[model samples]
Target: MNAPTATLHLLPEVNQREVPAALIEALKARFGDQCSTAQAVREQHGRDESSFEVPPPAAVVFAESTTDVADAVRLASQYDTPVIPFGAGSSLEGHLLAVQGGISLDVSRMNQVLSINADDLTVTVQPGITRKQLNEEIKATGLFFPIDPGADASIGGMTATRASGTNAVRYGTMRENVLALEVVTASGDVIRTGTRAKKSSAGYDLTRLMVGSEGTLGVITEITVRLYPLPEAVSAAICSFPSIEAAVRTTIQTIQLGVPIARVELIDHNTVRMVNAYAKLGLREEPLLLMEFHGSPTSVKEQAETVQEIASEFGGNAFEWASTPEERTRLWTARHNAYFAAVQSRPGCKAISTDTCVPISRLADCLLDSVAETDASGIPYFLVGHVGDGNFHFGYLINPEDPKERETAEALNQKLVMRALKLEGTCTGEHGVGLHKMGFLVDETGAGAVDMMRTIKRALDPKNILNPGKIFAL
Candidate 1:
């Protein structure tokens, strides 16, 4: 119950580890123009969306194929140097930061959709491809990928983090949708797990293991993800509530009664106001729910009617529909930009994002307490959630130069995570344990389980060269 004994200390000074001169020469000879030690490029790969202080890699290797990744890893392994995988560089938990200073395997150039088996409803892609690009490529196939993490993040990054968004309520998270993976182990051995088959009973569930490993065990070079048929009819709507509690209750009931809602998101009053100002939309600034329904026309109507009845019981207003594709895109775009809107509202402030997910039954309690605590803390914050799956985030906007605000935000985040663990839920529903949740991982899973994880890490990567010092301090 007390605050976790561990605490984040001062942002330690970046200790740039020295790369062996021989290794650098070898890399230069092997990669030629593809290898770079340019200060700008290293700095770019050093940080992600997280507010962690930048700790740049010694060099960046723009890999164009799985062979390139394997060779880089093999070379790094030879020298016991850390290798951090880089995709779109949008990771929220400092997953890309060169914490120990090594080589960054930038796979962005590997972007490609290798094959789309329309008959099997599966698509195999190089890890560097982004979700938006994948959807655009396969749009004409009448099949779409459902896992939307709000970021145009690379599929490899999404798999690493086990990301999910609003649509997870009905479709599922990366844990469920990612069918298989081609991983290059720390030893530079290429291996494939799972098949296109709908089910398998072979050996270990290695695919699932790599899906959320956060690149600790191996590098995901290729991914085969399940796809779904585009809905015949789709509708998006926004409903405002007089209070946050009302909005959460509506979501709880809608899910409990099995309304089959495709997506349901909760944006608190402050976030709604920020989005309104940023997106130039005219609407009541109150706690709001953005929902979408996908099915046959009659089924969509029925689901809408059921959800409306549930909403009315909780004082939800009539829905404002975005019936057309363009309208839907615009509305979702604004929702996706909620983080930027919150940050922009605070001018020069940076955001410390908190990802907490609790059981559906306790969603209201967790959120109410969180909102009240942040409100009393006097720190500016915005709230949004994929409430359908009991997952939400609080973007605590603060001037990075102010230590007091930073401390306050971290304290609040710790409390939120502890609360979620108490409710028999996870500290993070989608966001994997990058640098930020290392302590929470120990607290939530206990020392013994984490020890087993370390055992697996050692068995797979004895040198601890793959994304070292990430999920836990080894």
Candidate 2:
């Protein structure tokens, strides 16, 4: 648990390429006021929630349609300038950073629900439509999208990151829910992949390829995803445990027993206290599991009973149910705000988050060992997880000005990732391999597989103008 002396170099070396005046001129001419060179606009679009600092992009293009995106990208191609797609800017990794100077193609203006096939259980939306907005727009249809991701991230950003969240245990992640896409490739050509159909065996599976490409492959202009009917019966509950191991064990047993849990989240004692302080809630300060069930009324009751039995076996306290919709919303909102709460606890500190996922059977081993090591290291941290799916996060709060704390936090992250890999898990469960996890990507996927990725990137983006210097160094 000793802190390593050398820091983990998370940010890539900045190699800003020039954005010629001619390119900016062409953009302004084509889109008029939609193209901006103001420092505020450029700076706002250049960064995300990641703890990295770099120069802002030279210009920002507020694209309102596919044609706008294509034209802007086409112009950038001419100047060999990078075009980094911008969504809601909720990405935890450095996915939105302009490490290599480029134009920030802001798509937040394109928010719209283009079509809703209620009968087919599918909805197509513009890339900038946020998840919350999508659900509100489609609520009249008695259906909703389930990939929450905590943040009200844009659908395009979620699709790019292959994101999942609390309900992922039952409804699945973006990788499984997304049915098709309309992407603007590096050459600024608009192409469609897949269809409204549930499954396909087409050539190359390009839609799957683009789903987790993290904007390195292309700009996601439109997305068609599956939706589910509002559950007939729903119930939410919280159960506190004496220790993290007991809570994790309860989750392991619940999933092992084949319960169809809609959402199962773990918040360690540290995070629980933070959430209480930030949200002004009266939740018990202990390792806690917040869960929800969905199905017929009889089935929901049975599922809850079964889970309660399992929890009791693991020394879990009596359940605290949040049955009303308002109650459930308030509870989940606090859980989503856990990261912000932790950051607020340590003023002027930035969080370096980890996203490692392992098999359901190995959840206890991977999490408990890491918890012990982190405790011994003496770095302030917050732990939360979608443990039903064996995916979790550890947010290490470090002062930006403190070099020693940064090194210690990064060192802890490296050990945790390597341990997850050893347990046959992935370095990233949802967050893509942005600048922060590039080296671990190599370790997890091996040199040969990463080389194959490089080959595909080169073929698609010969000039490397589409989100240059991301995923891997080309």
Candidate 3:
């Protein structure tokens, strides 16, 4: 496959103009200079980090408050134009692509830390607040947000995607972290769900429902998320194994024995080589596990020792520990950049990242099968993942224009999804199905179940005005 020379996603027919003269005049009347149809500006909010490329929205509206969002939504609803919420533009699955092309509701201007209740151990923030900015603000409050997506992605985007990271095993995913949200419905009605309380037998559990809705349901304006006290002691370690099987086996044993893992990331040998070649890191080209322990000093030490013992049982070696703040940050930073390094490693090849989650009991088998399937396909790809949580990523390098490579990658990904579903798992663990994995999701969850989801989507967004052509087009 030849790499695409450029991506050309034109605007939908009804929205060829970035912003109609009437809409622009109305926007100026409502909030002067806050709305613009400037091509250069709209291009900024047009797409996310995913592979799907589209033309810039008709206009980019810099929303400064929830009321502003409501007003924009109401106006757009009147015009019956597609409205796509824009956050940090870091979505790996193209969650923010404006395919129908109405207006990009850029939320960065709405960034505000609403409240930080230390007693409640929760923080309320506007959608524009990035994960890193929120954590920095809460650093002095003795509490910090634990949902780290590594991209400084907006809190709203994180919640919408139900993103998880290296620390998911200990802190949980966005599903568990987001306690409540103030959402703008498609009809421009503002509503709130859940509470700051730790426990609730609340009706419907709408907070959880919207956590991974991917903006097809509603636009999140404000978010309330559970926070944790900064760990008393933080320790990160790197464990090396001679083979991928050994590393996976050690991870399986550690989990089976109930080790409280903060992070148990797997970097296959090929990925390690890629990182070294692309990022210039002095890492051994062997399958390695990047592990972290977070707790009291004694608890951290105990967890480390027990995990190391399990690793040794599976031929683990060079158990290097990084405890200092600098060391831990450096290790995780390098690990987070592993995706970019992998992409850079192969020149002229675009990355096709696939994710799957399996039950812990079947993790080893699933991972082993993945290696075999990749080899059988004869396509070289990089594999790394947050294995502690049974979620892994297969980043396949493919020529964007080559049909054969695309077919091979798709086949391997579909085969992997089938195996995962057979083991009673999900097709996507964190990354949402923006334009990809639509069929895999149906196969995993059954067509009837998918139909029910569509029914709900229609009920909430009858016009399909909210991010059309996303999450299975209506």
Candidate 4:
């Protein structure tokens, strides 16, 4: 398949669209101290963790409340300008690109834990509050938010990306934890969806809709998330496998046996090498499984023993446990930075990461095939995943200036997506289409379902201005 000559369009959030000086002054006057047009600030908002770089917004509006976000949206709409909500800008898929930049609705200023209903095991937080911050604030309440995207990313950004990490195998993704949201629509309408109750047969389930909308449907100003009680016991370990096939096969067996594994991550030999070099860890360069056990002491012991038994059958080594909190934190921290490790392997190279998930039964075949396909090139790459959930990522290293390397990476990604679809998986496990996966979305979901999505998008954002040129363009 030939790739399109899309020219890597420039949508710099700072200069993508013209914002009148008068409009800037007006916003500053109305919000007073909340609006900033400084060059550094604009430049910061212009870029994201995504490989693509675009223009920054004309001015950054540091929203302090839902009313503040609504006001900013109203002003942006009045000028017929595009508005992009800015969280931590950790979006790996260009979800926060200010394609038609106008005003970046920066939500970091609204970092506040509005309420924590421990009785209901729910917490309402301003969109700017990050998962790390929320957990810190709720630490004493005996309840914790378990959707760990690995990064200390803002909850709003996590929700926008429908992020999930190693913990996703046990705790689920943003799709399961986010109970409700307060969204500010394109028309500046404030709407609430979902309730504190555990379950709701409520009309429409709109909250769930926006949770993974990737900032296309609306700008989430507030979020209510379900929380879980801290387990009575927890343990983490790094286990080495003889080969990638053995590691993946053992994971499938564990899942098939219903071991209730909290987290099961696969790190291929290539990734293990990258992590060792990047994090300065001394370990044998082999396929590794980073496992975590969470439950009562007896339950955790039983779970670990069950995993050990399966691993032994696959020629696995004994678990090298990280007993201390610091050890566990450092281990997971390195895992979360896997992409960075891959990118750093080749200086000045950008990382192109793809997420593909397959059925547990086919996980071994899927991973082995994908790993082989990637290894055939011998390109500097890393393979890491939440294997227990059948989701994995291939972080491809590319020199953006070298057209061959870049295009080859894209082609490789497309092929990986194809293989995942063949195995009854999705083009994306957590990351939404944003712009990177638009073509793949069509391939995975077909043109008919894509059409229905476009229709709904048109109905909600009739002007096609909410997030122009994203998901689909008709």
TM per model?
Answer: 0.98, 0.98, 0.93, 0.94
Model 4 CA lDDT for position 465: 50
Clashing pairs in 1: none
Give the range of the ten consecutive residues with the poorest summed lDDT in model 3: 1-10
Clashes of 3: 4
lDDT of 4: 0.82
- Local accuracy by lDDT, each model: 0.89, 0.92, 0.82, 0.82
lDDT of 3 by residue, 1-474 (tens): 112212321112222424466876787688779988888988888866555557778788889999999999888877777788888888877677777778888898778899989999999999998988898888998888877666788999889889988778789999988999999999999999999988799689999989999898999999999999988998999989988888888888888888887888999888888878776677778999999898999999999999888889888998888999898876776678878887787777767778899987788888898889897887878998888888998988887677678778877877787788888887789988776666565667666777899999999999788887776756
The sequence of per-residue lDDT tens digits that candidate 1 reaches over residues 68-141 is 99999999989888899999999888888888889999999988999999999999999999999999999999
Best by lDDT: 2
Q: What is the lDDT of residue 334 in candidate 3?
A: 61
lDDT of 2: 0.92
Global fold similarity of model 4 (TM-score): 0.94
For residue 409, model 4's alpha carbon misses the true position, in angstroms, by 0.2
